[model samples]
Target: MSKRLKQLTKNADKNFNQMIIGVLIVAIGIFLWADKNYFFWPPQLRLLMNSEWSDIVFICLGICLLFTALTGNRSRKFQSILLILASAAVAMLLAEQVWHVLGAHKVEMIMAVILDAGLLTLLIRCAYKN
Candidate 1:
């Protein structure tokens, strides 16, 4: 490989994980912001009403993730815990979306049950992990 290319590759390798995490965080933040602002034309049903506090939670999580990424703290335990929490939040939100799209029925119930069970399993594993 060319010297310049090799150097670029090395730099990317060094920060790949952090870069990915940072990008995901920023992407999620943008998604949340867009949802709140109704960027999705015709707009799907709101998971939380405009008066709910969940928007603030999303904003805060996004900011924290971005900050962590910018600071290059890839191995922080706090970040891991935050991610776990976020995963649960995502699962719950997804269940709501499923309900919205599928309506109140068996399909929604099955999906939500599976999602919640998976989330619970993940939480248990994370808690017990050394």
Candidate 2:
């Protein structure tokens, strides 16, 4: 690529990264605001409002994976591993939260399982494709 084209690509990537960071910050702010105000939210949503240690860790890992994918700095295999690990962490987190809300309901439990399985499959496929 020409020097000008390369410079443009770099600037575009930097802008994209900044945009992603800005969006994440706004999202977190919204989440915190909602958590403080929405006391009467459903049980499932209430569970999300109160994040545990594992949830924070998984969320951080997901952010790291997102940056890695955006920067394209890691090898494909390494990125794939990160993606899989992040996906599993997310699945586990969701399952744990859902369990707290719907564990007693057999039908909900089955639905959660199906949803989790579908999510995991979709994440894995995207990981491998990239």
Top candidate on lDDT is 2
Off by over 4 Å in 1: 1-50, 104-130
What's model 1's TM-score?
Answer: 0.48
Off by over 4 Å in 2: 1-51, 97-102, 106-118
Q: Output candidate 1 Cα RMSD.
A: 7.3
* lDDT of candidate 1 over 21-62, digit per residue (tens): 444444544565555642221234443333235555655665
Model 2 — which ten-residue stretch has the worst lDDT?
17-26
Model 1, residue 111: C-alpha shift (Å)? 17
lDDT per residue for candidate 2 within 1-130, as digits (tens), equals 6976776566447445333432343343345444543222355566554555444554465566555645553477766676667566647645654664465444534654665566566666656666
Structural similarity to truth (TM-score) of each candidate? 0.48, 0.48
Global lDDT scores for all candidate models: 0.52, 0.53
